[model samples]
Target chain A: MTIKVAILGFGTVGEGVWETLHTHHEYIQKKLSTPIEITSILVKDSNKKRNLPDSVQVTTDIEEVFQQPVDVVLEAIVGKQPAYQYVTRAIEHGAHVITANKEMFAHYGPHLLELAKEHNVWIGYEATTAGGTPVIRTIDQMLQVNQIKSIQGIVNGTSNYILTQMTKHQNSFEDALLAAQQKGYAEADPSNDVDGYDAFYKAMILSQLAYQDQPNWDEVYLEGIRTISSQDIDKATIQGQKWKHVATIELRHGAPRASIQPMQLNEDHPLYNIDGVENALSIQTDLLGSITLSGPGAGKLPTASAMIEDLLYVFQKERQQEAQYV
Target chain B: MTIKVAILGFGTVGEGVWETLHTHHEYIQKKLSTPIEITSILVKDSNKKRNLPDSVQVTTDIEEVFQQPVDVVLEAIVGKQPAYQYVTRAIEHGAHVITANKEMFAHYGPHLLELAKEHNVWIGYEATTAGGTPVIRTIDQMLQVNQIKSIQGIVNGTSNYILTQMTKHQNSFEDALLAAQQKGYAEADPSNDVDGYDAFYKAMILSQLAYQDQPNWDEVYLEGIRTISSQDIDKATIQGQKWKHVATIELRHGAPRASIQPMQLNEDHPLYNIDGVENALSIQTDLLGSITLSGPGAGKLPTASAMIEDLLYVFQKERQQEAQYV
Candidate 1:
C-alpha cells in the first residue's frame, strides 16, 4: 500500500519531514509494512531553487496540492486561520490530517476532533504540544487506565532555554533571551514562548485530553520568565535550587486548576536537572503515582519525526482494521 | 457492548485487577465506550474466603473458565508452564490474551505474538515489563516512528528499594533485602530481583518489541546488586552518585546489545532522583532525542492498572475493526 502525503508548508519542520522521508525511506518502509510517497509540496514561492525529488509536485498554490488525491495531509503551517481551514478541508476530503499548529489545536481542537470522528479519519496533533516527546501518546495510553490528578510541565522550550542560561551564567534574562535567539531556539518575536502564551496553549490542549473538560481559558493564570531577576536566581541558588518555568494543571475538588509560572526546584525534583531546552512533565495519577516524562521540547527533525509517526499510525490502524475480517 | 473477561491466578495482581474493575468500573466503561465484566476467576484454591461481586465465578479448574465463552483472558499468573499454556489456549479459543507474566513473556513472547497475529486476536503484555509505567505502550508507539538507539532503565522495583535503603540509611545489602521483604517489595526468594534475573527478563522482552529481533538469552550478560557492599555504596555517595539496578538494551550497530547491571549514576541523570521502588527509563531515539519516563515500577494497584490499560486497548482495537466494515 502506498500512502500519498501532501505537505502544506515547506519550512524548517516541513523540510525535515521531507528529508527524513528521503533519507530513512527504507527503514520507515520496513517498519510501516507499506510504502509512503510525498505527492505534493506547498511552498510560499515555487520559483525558489531547491533540491528535491522530481516526482513530488512542488507548487505555490495550496489548491493545487488539494486537487491531487491525498491520503494524509501533513500540515506544517503555523497560526490559526488557514491551518484550521486546511485541516478541516483535508479531513472533509477523506484524508487523515497531521498538524504541528499548537495555537490552532488549543483553541479549536475539540471541534476538530469531533469532525475527524464524524469523518472516520484521524486528526493527529502529537507534534503540536511537546514536539518530539511522546508525552501526548503516553498520556493517551495512560488515560485508559489511570486518571491523572495533576500535571506539572516545562512545556515551553524557549523559556526553559532562557532560564537555564540565566541560571548557568548568572546573567540577566535579556541576555539569556538573546543567547536563545542566536541559538535558533527562540524567535525574534519570542512573545508566544517567553510571555507564556505557548505554554498556556499547550496546557489547554493537555487539560482537554487528560481531564476531558474544557477549562475556562480566561481563568487559567500565566507568568513568564521576564520577572526572574539575577538576584532571584542567586537567592534560589543559595537555597540549593534552580529556577524553572513550569506549566501546571492540577485537579482540585475534581476540577482542574491551572497555572504557568517560574518554580524554584530543589535537587529531589525531577524537573530540577532538566536544563537547556529540555522539557519535562510529571503526571500524578491515582494509581500510578507520579510519572515524569522528559525530552527535547522542540526542533525541526523532532517535530517532523512526530508527524511521521502520526502518518504511519494512520496507515497501520487502517491495515489492522482491514486485516480483522480477512 | 459488554466484553467478557476471565482472570487467571487470583494473586496480588489478580486481586488488584478485580478491585480496580469494581472501583473504577464506571470511569473505565465510559472511556472504553463499553461495559466490561469479569466472568470467571481461576484460583489455586477456589474455596478460599474472599469478598467479591456475586457475578464473578471463582473456580479452581482452569478448564471451567476455558469452557465458558471468553472475549479476553487476564493472565496474572507468574512463572512459565501453566501461564504459557493458558495464554496459548486462550488465543486458540478466540479470546484475546493480556498477561503480566515477565518470565513467560521473555521466553515465549515472540511465539505468542505470532500466535495472536495468526489467530487474529490481540496479546498484550504491557504489565509484563515495567508494571504501570506505560513503558511498553510508549515503546510500542515509539517504534512506529523513532528507532530507539538506547534504553537506560531502573526496571526492577525490589532491587531499587534495596539499593535506595542501602544508600539512605547506610545499611548493608542483606539488611536492606530483609527490610524490602518485610515491606512486600521483595519475594522471600528474591534471587530473581537481587540477582538481576527479573530485570534480565524485562530487557529481553523490551528488545523483542523495540528491535523486533530476538536477542539470545544466554548471550545477554547479567550482574546482580548482591555484590554491592556498604563500602561500595559509600564510595558512590562520596562521588555524588547512587547505585541503581538498570536493565539497558542499546542498538550498537543495527542489532541489539543488552545488559542488566548496577550502575553508579551522577546527579544530572534523570534516573538519579528515582528512589525507593520507583522506576525510570530513558529511550534515546534516532530522531527523537533522549526521552525519559519515570513512575511506580510495581505494586498491587499499579501492575493491575497496567493490565486494565491492556484490557481497554484490546476492546478499543476490536471496536475500530468492527467499525471499519460498517
Candidate 2:
C-alpha cells in the first residue's frame, strides 16, 4: 500500500520532517513494508529556496494540498488559525491527520476527535505534548484497561533547559534564558516557554487525552522561573531539595484540573533528577500506580521523529481496519 | 462476550492479580466493556487457607487449569519449570496467555510466540520485562513505527534500592544491601539481585522483545552493586555524575545484545538523575529519537498491574479480531 502524505508547513519542524523522510526514506519503507511518498508541501512562501526535490509540488494554497488526494496530512504549523481549518478539512475529506500543533489540540481536541471519529479516520498529535516521548501512544494503546488519574512532569524544554542551567551553573534566569535562546531551545520572545504558557498548553492536551475532557486551563495557576533567583537555587540545594518546573494535570472523579509551576522536589522524587532540556512525565493511574517517561522535549529531529511516528501509526491503523475487509 | 480466566500459581503476584480483580472488577468490566470472571486458580497447595471467593475453584493440577473451558490463562508464577509447561498447554488449548515470568520468556519466547500464532491465540508478556513500566507495550505499539537502536537503564529494583541508599547515605554496599533486605526490597540471600542475575534476566527479556530473539545472555557482562563501593559513588559525585546500575540492550542490524552493570552516568544523561528504587530505560530509536521510561520495577501490585495490562491487551485484540467475524 502506498500512503501519500502532504506537509502543511515549511518551518523548522517541517523542514526536519522533509529532511528525515528524504534521508531515511528507504529504511522506513523497508521497515513498514509499504511505500510512502510526500506528494505536496504547503508553505507561506512560494519560493523559500529550500533544497527540496523538484519532483514534489510546492504551493501557498493550503487547500490544494488537501485536495491532492493525499491519504495523510502532516501539520507542523504552530498556531491555531490555518492549522484548524486545514486539519478539519482534511478530516472532512476522509484523510487521517497527524499534527504537532498543541495550541489547536488544547482548545479544540474534543471537537477534532469527534470529527475524526465521524469521518472514520485517525487523529494523532504525539508531538503536541512532549516532543518525541511516546507517552501519548503508550497511554492510548497499552493502558487502555486502566484509569489514568494524573500526569505530572516538566513538559517544556525551554523552561527545563533554563532552570537546569540556573541550578547547575548557578546562572541567573535572564542568562539561562539567553543561553537557551542562543541554543535555539527558546524563541526570540520566550514568553510562551519561560512564563509557563507553553507547558500549560501541553498540560491541557495531556488532560484531554488521559481524562477524555478539557481541563481547567485558566485555573492551572501558572508560575514561571522568572522569580527563581540564584539565591533560591542555593537555598534549595542547602535544604536538600531540587527546584523543578512542573506541569501537573490531576483527574479526580473524572474532572480534570491542572497546575504549571516551579516546585521544590524532594530527594526521592523522580523529577528531581530530570534536569536541562530533558522532559519527564509521571503518569498516575488506578492499575499501574505511576509510570514516568523522560527524554528530549524539543529538537529538530526528535520533533520530526514524533510526527513520522504518528504518520506510521495512522497508516498502520488504517491497514488493520482495512484488513478486516479481506 | 464473557472472557473466562484461570489464575496460575497463587503467590505474591498471583494474589495481587486476584485482589485487583476483586477490588476493581467493576471498573475493569466497564473499561473493557465486557464480562470477565475468574473461573479457576492453580495453586501449589490446594488446601492452603486463604481469603478467596467461593465461586472460584482451586486446584493443584496444571491440567485442571489448561484443560478447562477458559478464554484466557494468567500465569503469575516466577520460575521456568511449571510456567513453561502451563503456558504451552494453555497455548495448545487455543487460550490466550499472560505471563509475568521473565526467565521463561527470555529463554523460550520465540517458541511460545510461534505456538500462539499457530493456534491463533495471543501471548502477552508485558510483565516479563520492567514491571508496571509498560516497556514491552510501548515497544510493541509505538516503536513499531520506528527503528529501535538501543535500550539502556535500570531494570531491577532491589539492586537499585541498595545502590540508591549507598549513593544518598554514603553507606557501604553490604550495609545498603542489609538495609534493603530490612526494608523488604531484597531477599535474605540477596544473591540474585546483588549478583546482577535478576537484571540479566530482564535484559534478556527486553532483548527478546526488541529484536524478537534472545541475544547472548551469557555474555551480558553482569556486574552488580556488590562491587560498587562508596569510593566509586564519591568519585561519580565529584565528577558531576551518578552511580546507577544500568542494563543496556544495544540493537544493530536488527540484532539485539545486552549488558547489565554499573556506569558513571553523565550529568546530562536522563538515567543519571533517576535515583532510589526507580527503574528507567532510554530507548534510542529512529523515530521518537530518545524516549525514556522510569517507574517502580518490582512490587506485588506493580507486577500484577502489568499482568492486568497484558490481559486487557489480549482481550482487546481478541475483540478486534472477533469483530471481523460479525
Candidate 3:
C-alpha cells in the first residue's frame, strides 16, 4: 500500500524532509517494504522560484493541497491558522496526520487526538519535542508498562545555544544572540526561542503525552535565558555548575505541572553536560527508575529523520488496521 | 487471549518480573487488555525455597517446563547452553521468547531470530543491554530511519561499580573488586564482568542490532579494568577525565568490530558522566546525528522493567498480527 503525504510548508523542516527522502531513498524503501509518496506541497507563494520535483504538485491555496489525493498530511508550517484548518480538514477527510508544529499540538493535542481516534487515524508529533530523539516513541511504549513520574530536559536550542556560547566563547547574551542569528540558529525576532515560548510549547506537548492530557499553557511559567549574563556564566563555572535552560514536566500531587527556566545545575546533573543544540530528557518513572535520552534538538536531517519515523509508524498502523478488515 | 508464560530460572529477574506484574497489576490489565499467566518455572532445585503462588507450577527438570501449557518462554537463566536449548525448543513449540540473557543472545541471536520468524513469533531481548534504558527498542524504531554509524558507551555495571568505587574511595583495583563483591555488585568469580566477557557479550548484542547481522565476536578484542590502577584513575582525574568500562561497536569500512575496555574519557564525552552502575549507549546515526540513552543497567527492578517492555512489544505485535488476520 502507498502512503500519500502532503507537505504543508516549504520551510527548513519541510525541505530537510525532502532532501532526506532523496538521500536515504533506497534505505527507507527497503525498510518500509511499501511506497510512501510525497504527493503535494502547500506553499504561500506558488512561484517562489524554488527547485521542486516535477512529480510534486505545488499550490498556494491550503484547500488545494488538502483536497489532493493523500493518505497522510505532513504539516511543517510554523504557526496555527491555515495549518490548523488544513490538518483538521485532512483528518476530517480520513487521512492520517503527522506534524512538527509544536504550537498546534501543544494547544489542541487532546482535541486533535480525539478527532484522529474518531476518524480512525493517528496523529504524530514526535518531532515537536526533541527533534529526532525518539523520546515520544519511548514514552508511548514505556507508559504501557511504567508510570512516568516526571520529565526534565534542555528543550530549547536557542537558549541552549546562547548559554553554550557564553561558556565556550565567553560571549554575553547580546553577543550570543547576534552570533546565533548570524549562524541562522535564531530567527530575526527570536522571542519565541530565547524567551522560552518554544520550550514552553514543547513542555506542553510532553505534558500531554506524559499525562494523556494537556496542561494550562498560560499557567505554566517560563524564565528564559535573556537575563543570563557573562558574569552568570563565570559564576556558574567557578561554582562547578552549568547554566542550562531546562524544561520540566512533573506531577504536583496527582496533577501535571510544567515550566521552562534556566537552572544552575551542578556538575553531577545530566543536563550539565548537554551543551549547545543538544536535547536531553530524564524520565523518572514508577517501574523503570530514571531513563535519560539525549540527542540533537534541532537540525535539517534530525527533524527530517523524525518525520520519516512517524511515516513508518503510520504505515505500520495502517497495515494493522487493514489486517483487521482481512 | 492470555499469554501463557513459562519462566526459566526463577531467580532475580524472574521474581522481579512476577512482582512487577503484581505491583502494576491494574495498569498492565488496562494496557494488555488480555492478561498474562505464569504457567511454569524451571529451576535448579525443586526443593529450592522461593515464595510462589499456588497456580505457578515449579519444576526441577528444564525439559518438563517446556512441555507445559506455555505460549511464551521468559528465559532469565544466565548461561548459554540450557538457555539456547530452552529458547530453541520453545520457538519450535511455536512460543514467543523474551530473555535478559546477554551471553546467549550475543552468541546465537541471528539464528534464534530466524527461528522465531520461522515459528511466526517474536524473540525479545531488550534487557540484554542497558536494562530499562530501552536502548534496543530505540534502535529498532528510531535508527531504522537512519543509518547507524557507531555505538559506544559503558555497558557493564560490575566494571562500572568497581571503577566508581575506585574513584570514590581511592581504592586499588583489587580492593575495589573486593568491595564490589561485598556489595553483591561483582560475582565471587568476577570473571565474566571484571574480565570484560560481560561487556563483550553486550557489545556483541549491540553489534547485531546496529548492523542487522551477527558480528564476528571472536574477531573482537576484549580488555577489562582489572588491570586499571589507582594511578590511572588519579591521572584521569587530573586531566578532568573519568574512567569507564567502555564497550564499543564500530563498523570499520564494511565489517563490524567491537571492543570492551577501560577508557579514560574527558568531559566532552557522554560516558565521562555516566558513573556507578548506570549504563549508557551513544548511537551515532546519519539522520538524527548522535543519540544517547542511559539508565540503571542492572538490579532486579530495572531489569524487570526491561522485561516488561519486551512483554508490551510482544503484546503489541500480537495485537497487530491479530488485526491483520481478522
Candidate 4:
C-alpha cells in the first residue's frame, strides 16, 4: 500500500517537507511499510519554475488536488485565510491534516480539532508552536497525569536572537533586529516576531492545550521588546541577568492567565542561558518539578522535521488500528 | 470497569506510586474513564506496617498477587533476579508491565520486549531511565524522523548531587559522598551510584533505544567520580568548566559506542548548568540539530510521576484499540 500526501504550498516549509521526505525516503519507507508519494501540490502559480519531478502534479486549483483520494494534506501556507479554509476542507475530505501555519492554528485550532473529531480524522499542528521542540507532544502526554502549574518559554527565535545579539555585542535593539534581518533570522517587517504577536499566538495554543481553556486575547498582557534599550541590557548584565522575551501562562485562582513580555532572567533561571535562535520551554507541574526542553525553535528543516514526525505519527496510528482488526 | 494493578515490591518507588495514585485518584479516573485499583501489593513482609487502606491486599508470596487477574503489573523491585522473573511471569500472564528496575531492564529489556510482543502486551520502562524527564518518549518520537547522532546525559542523580556539592563547596569526594548519604541521596553502600554502574545501565538502555542495538558491556569504558579531588574541581572551575558524570553513547562508524565517565563541560555546553540532583539528556540528531531535556532525575514523586505516566500510556493504547473496534 502507498500513502498519498498533498502539499498545499511550495514555499520554504513545503520545499523542506519535500526535501526531508526525499532525504529520508528509504528509512521512512522501511518504518511505515508503505511508500509515501506526493500526489499533488497546490501552488499559487503552477507556471513557476520548479525543480521537482515531472511525474508529481503541481496545480493551482484546490479542487484538482482533492480530485484524487489523499490520505494526508500538509499545509505550510502562512496567515489564516485560505490555510484555515484548506484545512477545514482537508478534514471534511476525510484526510488527516498537518499544518505549520501558526496564525491559522492559533486562531482556529480548537474549532478545527472539533471538526476533526467529528470527521474522525487527526489534525497535527506540532510545527505550529515551537518548531522541532516536541513541546506539543510533551504537553499532551504530561497532561494525562500532571496538572501543569506554569509554563515559561522563549518561543520566538527572532526575538531571542535579537536579544542575544544585544546582550553579547552591546548593540541597540534596532541594530540587533537589523543584524537579524541581514542574517535572514528576522523578516523584512519584523513586527510579528519583535512585537510579540508570534509568541502570543504560540502561548495561546499552549494555554488551550495545558488548561483546556484559554485566556481571552484582551486579558493577556502583551509587551514587545522594542522598548528595551542598550542601557537596560548593560544594567541587567551588571546584575548577572539577561533580557529574554518570555511567553508565560500560569493557573491563577484555578484560571489560566497569560502574558508575553521582555523579562530579566538571572543565571539560575532555566531559560537564562537559552540564547541566540535557540528556544526553551520550562514547565512546572504539581508532580514533577520544573522540567525544561531546549532546542531549535524555528528553521526550515526543523519545522519540516516536526511536520514529518506528525505524518509518521498519523501512519503509526493507522498501523495500530489495522493491527487491531487483523 | 476498574483496571486491576498488582505492585511488586513495596519500596520507595512502590510507596510513591501508591501515594501518587491516591493524590490524583479523581483526575486519573476521569482521564482513563476507568478507576485504577491497587488490587494487590507484594511485599517482603506482609506483617510490616504500611499506611495503605485495608481494602488493598498485601501479600508476601508472588503467587498470591497473581491469583487474581491483573491488567497491569508494576515492578519496582531493584535487583535483576526477582524483577526479571516477575516481569516474565507478568508478560506470560498477558498483563502490561511497567518497571522502575534499571538493572533488570538494561540487561533483559530487548528479550522482554520480544516476549511482550509475542504475548501482545506492552512494557513501559520510562521510569527506568530518566525520572520525570520524558527523554525516552522524546527519543522515540525523534527517532521516527531523525537519525540520532549522539546522546549525553546526567542520568544518575546521586552522582550529580555529589559532584554539585564538590563543585560548590570545594568538598573532597569523600566529604561530598558523605553529605549525599546524609541527605538520603546516596545509599549506605553507594558503589552502584558512585562507581558509575547506575549511569552505565541507563546508557545501555539509551543505546538500545537509539541504535536498536547495544554495545558489549566490556567495550564500554566506565569511570566514576571517585577519583576526582577538590583540586580538580578548583582547576576546572577556574577554567570556566564543571565536572559532570556524563553517560554518553554515539553512533561511531555506524555502530554505538557508550561510556560513563566524569567529563569537563564548558559553560556553553547544554549539560553544564545541570546542578544538584537535576538530570539532563542532550541528543544530537541529523535533522533537528541538538535538543535537551532537563529535570529531576529521581525522587519519590518524580519517579512515581514517570510510572503513572507509563500507566496512563498503557490505558491510552488500550482505549485506542477499543475505539477502533467501536
Residue A44 accuracy (lDDT) in model 4: 88
Please give, for residues B8-106, the per-residue lDDT of candidate 4 as tens digits: 988999999999999999999988988789999999987888888888889988888889879999999999988899999999999999999999999
> Could you list the chain B TM-scores for each candidate?
0.97, 0.95, 0.96, 0.98
Instruction: Judge candidate 4 at residue B156 and give its lDDT.
Output: 93
Tens-digit lDDT string for candidate 1 (A137-162) = 88888888788888999999999989
Misplaced by over 4 Å in model 2 are: A141-143, A252-254, B170-172, B229-242, B252-255, B322-325
Residue lDDT tens for model 3, A140-220: 988888888989989888789889999988998999999999998899999999999889889988988899865676778
Q: What is the C-alpha lDDT of each candidate?
A: 0.88, 0.82, 0.86, 0.93
Share of real interface contacts recovered by each model? Answer: 0.87, 0.58, 0.87, 0.85
DockQ of each: 0.76, 0.54, 0.72, 0.86
Best by DockQ: 4
Best by lDDT: 4
Name the better of 2 and 3 by TM-score.
3
The DockQ of predicted model 4 stands at: 0.86
In terms of lDDT, which candidate is stronger, 1 or 3? 1
Q: Which stretches of model 3 miss by more than 4 angstroms?
A: A320-326, B323-326
Q: List the residue pairs that clash in candidate 1.
A: none
Better of 3 and 4 by lDDT: 4
Stretches of candidate 1 off by over 4 Å are A253-255
Higher DockQ: candidate 2 or 3?
3
The alpha-carbon lDDT assigned to residue B215 of candidate 1 equals: 68
Best by TM-score: 4
